[model samples]
Target chain A: MSTTNAVELRNVVKRFGDIAAVDHVSLEIRDGEFFSLLGPSGCGKTTTLRMIAGFEYPSSGSIVIHGREMATIPPHRRPVNTVFQSYALFPHLTVAQNVAFGLEMQRRPKDEIAARVREALEQVRLSGFADRRPRQLSGGQQQRVALARALINQPEVLLLDEPLGALDQKLRKELQIELKSLQRRVGITFVFVTHDQEEALTMSDRIAVMSQGKVLQIGSPTEIYERPTCRFVADFIGETNFIAGKVIENGANAATIETPDGLRLRGLTPRPVRVGEPAVLSIRPEKALLLAPGDARAGHAFAIPARVELVSYIGSDTRITVRLNDQRTFDVWEQNTLSTLDRDAYWQPGEPAVLVCPPDNALVLTE
Target chain B: MTLNALERERQRRERRTLAALLTPGLLWLILFFALPLVIILVYSFMTNGPRGNIVWQFTLGNYVDLFTRSIYFNAYLRSIWISVLTTVICLVLGYPLALFIVRQPPRWRTVLLFLVLIPFWTNFLVRIYAWQIILANNGLINSALRSLGLPPLTLLNTEGATLLGLVYGELPFMVLPIYAALDRFDFTLMEAAADLGASKRRAFWRVMLPMTMPGVAAGSVLVFIPTIGQFVVSELLGGAKVDYLGNLIQRLFLRSNPPNWPLGSAMAMAMMLVLLALILIYFRTTTEEDR
Candidate 1:
């Protein structure tokens, strides 16, 4: 991939009258990257995508697409297309006609338009459903038609706003994989917006996690999930266990925190933390390992004595809820790696155990 | 079998309920609507007596005179031309107004629709008289011109005044249906069109206009049929100078030098058939997507 940016925003702000829907968000979507803006509803992720597509303008910042400042350009003049959440297929037009709309608007010759439309439909695997109206197609079929319609334009950037949000779970997962591969084959820069974190994690090359109109973090899926720099990012992405405490020592690469009950825990400090300041230590549920007390000291891992409160065996993993010595409850998911039918093989409730996690796997985050 | 008997009983009850629902409307149409047309049809084939009386003698003279005479032929053509012009003008003026109203915020949309409907609060005839006061030679525009020391042009007692009055009377009919269509329109489709690189004008033609066509067809029918048969505007505003089909029919039936009932019935029948044909053709041309 080229190092050049396909789209860039410099401290963009969008306000609806008195309230800012997007506040000082600046990002550079690299060329041909499948970038995602992920957050819950009302976080301004869709608004940011709209500004990139020229549907909504930034209230107070510069937007550059391929090095050209897009200050006054209208949506039709912008070299971008959008796949709306509703699909927005023309109900009156057949599938092929809908896919050919963009080229027809550009006044291309009839034969070239026809050929490009055929190729676009084939790319989305809807080659035989061309003559059907939008209402006649199922939801997934309509979504593919929408994709074919937008992709036929060969735009420099493609904006997708929760395009799979209305589908069933099985269909959504199927489309997620299909869409990611389609983006790769086309090699077009995609700026996707969704509230589904798993969907974002599975499909995106990089992600921008937003909350309340501000971008909290931006990184790859691994960096975002494994090493969130802030408390919101850690809490928003997945299931996390947070223990509120005060920092007792700030070392070169890690910080140690003491809880109110006088239990000490050390974790990696992804962001700066001052000594004696209030902070929180965060660890993912799957990352924390539950082991017998004798196995805790084998790898220089930090260990806390706990009693198993509850054990629930799901097929893929065993979820164990444990109470720490300081009286805080923590959850740990142990993967079911071996096939076993014996009931006595699993850990029972009220049993003594140790909760251990590597220092690098835990993060010390600031509010 | 018992199952067959149950199905038969269900079908009988459904038929009874359908008949009960349709009885009143059917009776009303047959008595007040179909009976009058039948009377007109029977009268058109009879001879006219010397003193506005219908004589029991079969003749095709009225139908022949309707087609062969210059006066009746010219009146039919003029009425059609005037109605068509009025419908076109109303569409041109009302579409943008409907679009503008639909685009407003909800509170403002209600207020604007109220303004469009405000004229209906008064009697329709009173409204036409009000137009007469505005377009008269010594009326609103001429008075304003006189105040500005400009020459007062002839404003009333012309075809222009008649056309203006018809358009003013029928504009709400044109605006309401188009507004209803636009109000239900999904605005996101416009964004999709623009995102696909279509200019605002092209998007309007390709997306907005075609989807909203049902409203246009409805509005045209509402305006055209009424304007074609109108006589009050021409009489009051055009000073009874020209004979529209409605005025001519009125004279034949009620206010002629000597009443001509057979010819009047023939003329009315011809006008109704022509209108029915035009409406069918208009709907067929506009609704290709439905097929």
Candidate 2:
């Protein structure tokens, strides 16, 4: 991604009647960057994307696209184009006609419109299917046509509202990679919106995780997954096992928390955690390990004795659900490699085990 | 063996029950609709007797006379022309009304649609009489025009009054279907067009109109078919001076001495034929897009 900012939203707020659908969202998307708005339904991510596309006007703030204020501009006049969630391909028009729509609106030369339409179709890998209507194409092809329709305008910013949402899982994964590569090739700032965390994580250069009309965090995929600032973000971005505890000691870069069961745990603190403050210790399922009951623990290794209540083998990894002596459950995922147990030797119901995780891998959150 | 036979008998009995339940509506149509049409057909070919009863002799005189007589031909043409004019005008007026209704907020759409149907609930003849008062000389419209410093234009006993009555009577029939079609219209298609660079006008013409064509056709048939056969509106508003085919047919059957039933039957058959042809043309035009 380039350092130049292509689109900027300055304290934008959108209200539908009394409800603030988008509440004071401010973000800047860099030129050529693939940015995603990740949230659940009613999180106002789509509303924010619409504001940038000029489909919706911000109630209280300005939208700057390529250094121009898009407050009064309509969607058609904006330098941004949108690929709607429904694809929204003109059903009555042929594929060629649909793709040529933007060009025709620009009042381009007839010959040039035809040539560009052909080129756009080829770019989307739909070369010879121009005469067919949108209804005749498969969902993936329709999505490509939607992409071509927006991209042909050479827009400064392209807004995609769940473009792959209608596709099946297999097609969604295939298109995710394709869309990311397409965004890179086109070199235009792509503002994508999706509620699927994996889709956002796999494709976006940066993701803004939103909930209840407010963005909880905006960070790179690694940062969002590894260093989420809030409970919502930590739970939303990935799986986490949270333990309620009080901070017993605070060091320079790490902190120690004592669980209600009197188990002491040490973890690196991304944020300040004062001693005596209540906090939650978060650890990823994959970061935790299943150890034998007799294994010795080190100073930085936190281990808790538990009973394996369930073990599920999910292709590449085996997930074991363990219930601690204090009645709290924690999940541990082990990669299915040679070093792990064979399918027959995996944990059984009520098997005694110890859940161990490195101290540095534990995340501390103030709830 | 007896039980198996009884079970099979039960299945057959249930089938018979379904047929018996459906027989009444089927028989009703055959008696009230099909039988009358058959009678009209048989009477159109028979000769009218001295006492206006149908004679046993088969003759084409009534059909021949219908074509040869200038009065009958003119009346038929005038009714057809008026119905066509009314259908066109209703389409032009109703489309925008439907569009406006569809564009309204969802909660208001029901109330607005109800407003369109309220006038239809009143008795047809009573509604025509109400219009007669409104369009009459020194009536509401004339008074309004005079108050505006305009000359009191003559409206009653003219073709303009008949056309106005036709449109006013059939407007709800035209508006509802169009509203339904437009209300269900995929607005995303229009947005897609606008995004592709279509001006608002182009988007409306290319996307909006084609999608709603079926509604337009249905509304046209709804307005045209009834207006063409209507006698009450013309009799009340046109003052019986302008003889439409419906007025001619009514006069022949109800008022003429000895009741010229054969000619009336022939005229009625001709009207059915015309309506059938128009409907066929409409269906053909609409379905051609599929191919």
**Predicted model with the maximum DockQ:** 1
**Backbone clashes, candidate 1:** 0
Q: In model 2, which regions exceed 4 Å deviation?
A: A109-111, A131-133, A247-254, A262-264, A272-277, A290-297, A301-311, A339-356, B1-77, B103-107, B141-153, B251-274, B285-291
Pairs with steric clashes in candidate 1: none
Worst 10 residues of 2 chain A by lDDT: A294-303
lDDT of 2 by residue, A272-298 (tens): 889999988889999988887887763
Per-residue lDDT of B238-257 in model 1, one digit per residue for the tens?
88898888999999999986
The superposed Cα distance between candidate 2 and the true structure at residue B40, in angstroms, equals 5.8
Looking at model 1 chain B, which ten-residue stretch has the lowest summed lDDT? B282-291
Q: What does the lDDT come to for candidate 2? A: 0.88
Query: Cα deviation of A238 in candidate 2 (Å)?
Result: 1.6
lDDT against the true structure, per candidate, is 0.92, 0.88
Q: Best-fitting candidate, measured by TM-score?
A: 1
DockQ for every model, please.
0.83, 0.47
